[model samples]
Target: MDILLSICAFILAILGIAGCIVPVLPGTLLSYGGLLCSYFASYSQMSTSALWIWLAVCIAVSLADYFLPAWMTRRFGGSRAGSIGATIGIFVGFFAGPVGIILGPFVGAVIGELVNDRSDFAKALVVGFGSFLSFFVGTGIKLIVAVGILVHVVADIWVHVVADIWPAFWNWLTNLF
Candidate 1:
């Protein structure tokens, strides 16, 4: 049962990592959940403060990741159409694969602009550009935070595991020097 729980935790961690890049998933939160679960499995062995800190960080990072992109797009002159297109592109790109990821936002913008007015390509492009720029920036920020959060989770787990098994030692079998 313990091993099963640990395996479940690892699976959640993997999902969290994927969530970081895919946009549809809350990578930070999911990753943090993994850490929490691991601690839960070994509750008697880990400190409570560490878990609490991680939980707080996870919540904060996820909140930032969620809000920053929308704020950035609005600040950069993106219109409702541009925002919608960018969101659509994000989902559409998921189906289209890597190349589609790059083009999805642009395609969404063009279509959005065309829908509003055929001759307003220039305006739409501008809005689309803002959306693209904001989204790109937002995703980058999100990725960084996600990586940071995951790293912290991993490190915390390592320290916890090591502490739990303190005094256990193995003779070095390899001489790298």
Candidate 2:
């Protein structure tokens, strides 16, 4: 029973982590759910309160993940055209899949800036690069929080498995490395 439950928890955590890069997945939130699972899976020294706080952090990261790029870009003097371009890029990237999603915003921002700024390459590049940097920052935040939540899950699960005198199995295996 414990093995099955732990497996389920691991799957959720993996999905959550994937969500961070793919943008199509609810990575941070799913990570929180996995942590919740491990925390409640069995009798152990799980810190429920700590996991709760961590979940809040994950939620904040996820929310910021979507908004931070535009917010930072706007703050850095990105034009309205740049902002619209980033939005369109995000959705269009969804259609092109992962690689598309990754590069879509930068391309979109450049094009939008060019159209709005009347062929000014330097200005468009500025907005495009600023948006790209902000996006990386956002991605870093989500990855950090998601990993933290998953770590908590592992720690919580470790306690139960150890107490049960079962060997701790790294379910992530070759996938993690």
lDDT of prediction 2 = 0.76
Winning model by lDDT: 2
**Candidate 1 lDDT over residue span 84-145, tens digit each:** 66667767877897667656776676566566667766777776676566556656665665
| Candidate 2 worst ten-residue window by lDDT | 165-174
Clashes of each: 0, 1
Q: List the residue pairs that clash in candidate 1.
A: none
Residue 168 CA error for candidate 2 (Å)?
12
What would the per-residue lDDT of candidate 2 be over residues 1-177, giving only the tens digit for each residue? 666667767788888888888877888988887877776666546776887688678878877877876775576577888887876777787789777777778777877787788768887888878777766787788888878777877776866666553543554554567
The alpha-carbon root-mean-square deviation between model 2 and the true structure, to one decimal in Å, is 4.9
